[model samples]
Target: METTEKSVVRRFYDIVGSGRPEDLDEICSPGLVGHAGAGSNLAELKASIGSFLEPFPDLTADVRYLVQEDDLISSWVSFTATHEADFAGVPASGRRVKFAEWDLFRIRDGKIVEITQYCDLFTIMSQIGALPTAAPA
Candidate 1:
């Protein structure tokens, strides 16, 4: 049997990279929430995502692992991007950064009902200079 997690992640990346935002509304429930600890709801999550990716217009996620249990699907992803605009209150640094993350999805009735995810915030902040860079010995 094909793993749902792998298929979900693959479709998600394809959609996010090239599909319209409206497509998500069709595949996801209107009451969908992305309460990923730091995020409280889908709206907040969307805004946070906007802030976090403000600098990386060309961001791309590379899938490494995909696992699922019952209705939940999880995937590990590595992303690469170059900072060119403000992100999460940090000015662009023109630095190329790569980071890893996990996206956990909740599926129901053949559609995504909810989603929660985690990412490497430190890598993003440091790359954008919001966090001080370590000094070389």
Candidate 2:
């Protein structure tokens, strides 16, 4: 049971990194609840992912850990991508950035029903020069 649940979460990241957000329907439920303001439906989720992928076309997710407890899986992941296009109104800086994200997925049957993500936006923005970084003393 745990293995199956973890596998679903693994596929989620794999599909996202593959630059095919539409394929996520295979692993995600139709009524999935997502974090970071992603839409509650699969179609909306795909659109949201597509928008993000448009800017960072080469985004890749590296899974650091996948821990399972019953039907829920917690994943610690690092994503690396180059800012090749405008994102969130910020022009592309051609910077490569890596940021960590802690995500929780609830699996049912064989599909992910919900996802909660905690991302390191400060580090990502700082790396892309969208936010000012403090100098080391």
Candidate 3:
């Protein structure tokens, strides 16, 4: 059961990172909801992901860990991308950036029904020059 849950979560990331939006329906429920720092629903989540993918065409998420308990899966992921287009009103910086995030997913009937994410948004903004960088020591 744990292995199945972990595999579902892993496949979710794999399909997402592969830029295969069409495959989302197969893994995610129609009523999928995202909480915390992510979107609110499946459409919103897809749009958010699309926005990121637009700027970072090669965006990829590396799963540091995936732990499952019953219907819930917790994941630690590191994302890496090269800024090649505008993002969140910031022009392309042509820089490679990496960020880490923690996510919790709820799955039922072999589909992801809910998710919550915690990510370093400030660091991402700083990396993209949207936020001021720290002064040298």
Query: How well does each candidate superpose onto the true structure, as a TM-score?
Result: 0.81, 0.91, 0.91
Tens-digit lDDT string for candidate 3 (56-120): 88879999999888899999999998989998888999998999989999999898999998987
What's each prediction's clash count?
Answer: 0, 0, 0
Better candidate by lDDT, 2 or 3: 2
lDDT of each: 0.71, 0.87, 0.86
What digit string (tens of lDDT, one per residue) describes model 2 on residues 1-137? Answer: 44988888889999989999999989988888887646667787799889989888999999999998899899999999999998878899899999998988999999988888787878878888887677678
List the lowest-lDDT window of 10 residues for candidate 1: 17-26
Model 1, 55-81: lDDT tens digits are 687777788887888988887889888
lDDT for model 1: 0.71
Error of 2 at 123 (Å): 1.4
The lDDT, on a scale of 0 to 1, for candidate 2 is 0.87
| Stretches of candidate 3 exceeding 4 Å from the true structure | none
